[model samples]
Target: MYTGNLSNLILNSDSYKTSHWAQYPSGSEYLSSYIEARKGDYDVVFFGLQAFIKEYLSTPITHQDIDEAEMVIQAHGLTFNRAGWERLVDKHGGYLPLRIEAVPEGSIVPVSNVVCQVINTDPEFYWLPSYIETALLRAIWYPSTVASVSHYCKGIIRQALEKSADSSDSLTFRLHDFGARGASSQESVALGSLAHLVNFAGTDSMTALVAASRWYRMDKDMPAFSIPAAEHSTMTAWGRDGETAAFANMLTQFGGAGKSVSVVSDSYDLWNAIDNIWGGCLKDEVQNMGGTLVIRPDSGEPAKVVREALERLAVKFGTTINSKGYKVLPDYVRIIQGDGISPNTLGSIIDVVLKAGFSADNITFGMGGGLLQQVNRDTMSWAMKASAICIDGVWKDIYKDPVTSRSKRSKKGRLALINQTQGQPKTIKLDDLSTTDNLLRDVYVDGKLLIDDSLTTIRERAGW
Candidate 1:
């Protein structure tokens, strides 16, 4: 009854687009006639037949392919259905719907937390198990990954800010979700990046624009406002003569409306480039035009380059160029370091840069690839198992062999999750069947999803 735009979206998205349909036995029909008769009551089995059929229908598979695939899937579906149907019908006449309680999207949850739960309403609905596995796993895993990474990046930004006295004056840089396009699959790139961008404030205007238009119903031009706000930001090139010149020309064109620009200085001889080419007239021109200059170090020890640059600037402009009282010279030009900047590397870089008498506030980071693609397996692990079953008019929790690698173990009977804040955070799993205190709530019920979140909303909630 809470139907609205979400329901319409789901239905429209799920509906068959082509003028084609597949015929299959109804779930009830299969259960009563074939399943119950063949398999005895009170058995546990996975239900995936309908889901397989639905998946096949959604594709551009030819009729012949569908028939072949359906033959194989239906056999498995019917086999499980027979076992599961007899158990549910003869024992605990299915009454309860499956209940699932999961962490809200964008929340950073630790390992061993009950990130999700799946339960059945009627004992008979136990047969619906296999049908929901992939969806349930994906619903939790992808968002959790994005949330965890976003949390890490937030910490990095916080640390960088904390090391400086004038942190308030430091640029609040955007966290671009550049990984989505190059690293992930096409569909995932579109949706996953949107989901990531919800938490990571991306500098990639195009991704932000697309996410805004599709998910937020806003125009693509919204993020353009960020360009001018970060107008004096530096640009980087390969540090080669040709690369630097090309990049400078492009920046000149891009900053045509009197925008300030920064150039990469380490292409040939960084000292020569800065002291001779960039340090002389170009620096004067940019400053005279009321624009700040920035120099980026792409290769060779960043600390050394930043130290030299800082020393040069301090000697050249003893009073420093204070743009709006923010101290643009001495520490005038910003130093941006790009390659291999992980948490440890960043900490080391900051220590060195600070030691070299450069204000930590005068530096910016352009991190890509490394931060986004790196995954520490120890931080997260995934597992799926059969949690419950109806046996002889009773629902029993299923447990697995503790020592076995594939031990699909779960707590017994109707499980309730109790969230108790005692010192360190903890979750107590209760086995009492009578207690419904912390039963999992439904995120998607009766094939109707309960939540439809946008990337922007996700990003805001994630606080990245």
Candidate 2:
């Protein structure tokens, strides 16, 4: 069995030792959320917290843990509240000291709004999440940002399809996840790719598939699918002289399966592979096989390379313009740009290729960092702040309003997300919170899991 280094396990902030004062009465009940999509006005997808709570909240604080934790604090030249912590442990019987209510994972909540509420159920444990905030924010930040980006990209593809393709049937597969190697960690691959899979069905990251199946209770039929394809290593293993053999080999293997095959063509010469090999040599095989020949360009300017490749493929294999005024490539051939694909670049690439007369159906996107890791909490200006504090058997509205920047000011008062039956959702005070119909559900309480949603259910709720 693998054991961790003690220093890494035992180290923590001195502020966490006594930081409850850093919060209003020390991290009291607070309703916080992705109140603003500083990245843009895009709605935020509330997700990943269920997974976080499931993994981390399976057990609660034990007196032994508190005693050991207290020793670490005192060793760091900090005050350790042995009695205070023991009281909390004794009262809660070692469960998490907090309660969390969130909009169902995958519910598209307004970015400038509340998605969850964090409260200390036991007064003695108010200081607990003062340290836990980092992980909590992280749980919300990663998946929410990733889901937002993917959702926006999906909207772009949907628009491009409506305007450029014969049908929008390929919307789900237009943007594929090729970010596993680009993600920061195994957990990142799971959270980021699961978020993206909320919007798209094509993913090259198998690690994400396992995560969705295990955590979200999903099957292969739901989100994420991949096709048989060749990478540079697979081609180069055949040697450049054997490059023709590589192409022939790929076609020979998957061509007869009546499914699409993607070939990485830019290893030695992109145009040569597209013309001499894919278009020239395998043209008959591709046409007669009843499956697509996906030409993937891995280098060069995304817009320029994709546009130019489409032009070459059209000249060699031919094309037909769709009713939408954009030309459609022959059904047997298409271009998917996996290199340097992001929301911004993905759009420009599609536009340039479309202007060159290729339908959006003739193109797809595969993104790495931009789709998975290229974001921060500030990307959406997400924050979890105490809006209200319970003291003296009364709730008091509290917030920060720095005159230096109004944008940094936090929301005030106990909050309720009033998701209307026929109107846009609004945030109101708890006193005015009359509707039990509010979308927020108690997702985690103390040490118990209150909700568990499937990937299919999430996708349906997210309007996929």
Choose the strongest candidate by TM-score: 2
- Tell me which residue pairs clash in candidate 2: 20-26, 35-112
Instruction: Estimate, for each residue in 1-464, the C-alpha lDDT of model 1 and write its tens digit.
Output: 32233211111221221111112222321110000001111111111122222222123223333334334435444321333433433453321134445434454333444545565555445444434454444433443454455456556556655554355333335343435434444434443444445444444435535544553433234532223211112323333445445444534654444354556566557676666656654555444444445566667775666667766765555433232233334433555666555545666776775565455566666554544455322224444455455555554445556666542334343344444444221234545424434523345433334555443344444553
Candidate 1's C-alpha runs over 4 A off are 1-99, 120-127, 168-174, 180-182, 205-251, 256-265, 289-294, 301-332, 376-379, 404-419, 422-425, 430-441, 454-457
Candidate 2 Cα lDDT to native: 0.77
Per-residue lDDT over 1-464 for candidate 2, one digit per residue giving the tens place of the 0 to 100 score: 32322322113333463535444554354333323343344688877887777666665666656656666667667766667666766777767667788778888877667887777776655556554666677788889899989998888889889988889987888889999998999989998998998888999888888788777876445567899989999999999899989988888888764589999999999989878877787678877887888988999988998888988888888888788888778888888889998788878887887677778888988889999988878888887776776665667777889999888788888677776766677667767877456656778788888888888888887788
Question: What shift in Å separates residue 310 of candidate 2 from its native position after superposition?
Answer: 0.9
Q: TM-scores of all models?
A: 0.64, 0.91
| Count of clashing residue pairs in every prediction | 18, 2
